[model samples]
Target: MITPLKAVLVGCGSMSRAWTAAAKDIPYLELTGFVDVVEDAARQRAAEYGSPTAVVSADLENTLDRTRPDIVFDCTVPEAHMPVTLTALHYGCHVLGEKPMADSLENARRMVAAASEAGRLYAVIQNRRYDPNIRRLKAFLDSGEIGPITTVHSDFFIGAHFGGFRDRMEHVLLLDMAIHTFDAARLLTGADPVSVYCKEWNPPGSWYEHGASAVAVFEMTGGIVYTYRGSWCAEGLPTTWESEWRFIGRQGSARWPGDERMQAQVVTESGGFLSTVRDAIIPPLPPGAKTGGHAGIIREFVQCIQAGTQPETICSDNIKSLAMVFAAVESAETGLPVSVSV
Candidate 1:
């Protein structure tokens, strides 16, 4: 039998729980241990998960040398993803990192090149792309049920009570959250962004040190126009994050406003109809799937490791979406349209 890939997690934050649970369910992945800069946090997390092997990794080089796992998961802060990822690749291990790819496009490119030189699979944890609602939307678009998609719009509006890493961050909205919107836009439209212009604003009397709202217009490949509006501190929204997406095609359109408590619809040239919104449908699970994000992504990653193929939507694929966010940030900074080069 083919041996399961050995996996090591480099951070023990809130997302670690999901990662731990997902790893447990993937037979082809062996969870070696958890590592954190904070000794207590790492030990506590390991105890909570009933894992006896977790360790505090003050020196990553030493830890990796000892563990020699086949796959390294960099669930650390955005800024730290680069060093951890590059080190993992240098040590001849495949890497899967969380979103935003890296703190900057420059570092993201470097990481990509390192992965290429190492000849190992390098992927991003863009779990949102695996969302079932998104899958359903993609299916509808691909079926040409929505003909010649002309316009796309999405929102990541939320009134999050800031804490942890997000509270003390800079460029709050674009850096911290826009990757999901940007990636989803690219995925939903099946196109690349060519040019972008954006306007950003920090809400008056808001607690955030950075801009909280941004609206961007993107010129996508195939002449599709994409618009995204997002805010980290919109008030009085019943949900924590209210995501709305609409695809207006030449012959039809589709919209997913939220889950069951809300509603989604499709309008074709023939007629308009409301999609069946099951009440218990949860956000992370998306819409069409029997299972959801963490589980789905882990399954795919395991398959990729065994098949020796990069996941279709890997970090390299996500680079274009990251470029979109940077383009918007550039637009917001220079007050001019910015073209996406990647």
Candidate 2:
């Protein structure tokens, strides 16, 4: 019989709610306790989720001693991820942290090393890979139906006034939101980027000092070129997050027009080379197939911990996506392209 894994959550905010809900339903998972700096907040979250309200202490040692959970989930902000991860790993507990892993590349490197030394599973919440649409696309690319892939272009765009926390930041767009797009691009290509060139620009009436819209091009080791365009402050945009892709292969190409319910198109030629174009909408995931970002990510982390294997998408690879994001920032700052090695 499989034993239910105990979990303690830190940073009981909006994101934690999904984790809490998942814990209640998964037979092999249990939400043992909840902690946060704010007592009432922790108590309220625990009440909603039917978990214990441990004293929300700043010291992780104290929390671990009290909760003694097999897993510690760090749903904290970008800056808080490293300390929490290191502390949990030091105590011999598995950790699943929110994305970007850490605010800086140096911290991300240290976290990866720590996990390796401790022999514990450590991973980030990169939930996009499990999306039904993305999974279908991955299978298509792997099948070589369109021949050898040479280039990929993707876009993630949305317009919203984030007044709570996202807007009040120095590097607003890239650091705060573009990680998803960059990570998704890496997953799609199945290749690590060897170098990158990027540009960022803020409109005259933009609220953030840094550019809200940015573009980045990556050169992969196998000569695969990737181009990514993203924005978070485009006014009157009709989508929450519009995901589109253009994949070029030696024989044909595939395009994702950003509708989850519709089939994407794949075109391949049959003359000298097999040239064919067919409307193929990647099927959406079933209702219970893990749609919520944090929910899906946490479930995978638990599975990894129980199975004694690193999550296929670990921090080591995620650092590459982070590299792409920071490279864009660097390029934007210097008004020149920056090459990155991952």
Q: Model 1, range 90-193, lDDT digits (tens) per residue?
A: 88998887776888888999998898889988888777777666676566566664468899877777877767667667668888788877887887778998
Among residues 3 or more apart in sequence or in different chains, the pairs in candidate 1 whose N, CA or C atoms overlap within 3 Å are 132-286, 132-287, 133-286, 133-287
Candidate 2 residues 264-327, lDDT tens each? 4566446656456776544434455444456666776777777766675687777888888787
lDDT of 2: 0.75
RMSD of 2: 2.9
What Cα-based lDDT does every candidate model obtain? Answer: 0.76, 0.75
True lDDT of residue 245, candidate 1: 76
Off by over 4 Å in 1: 53-56, 238-242, 260-291
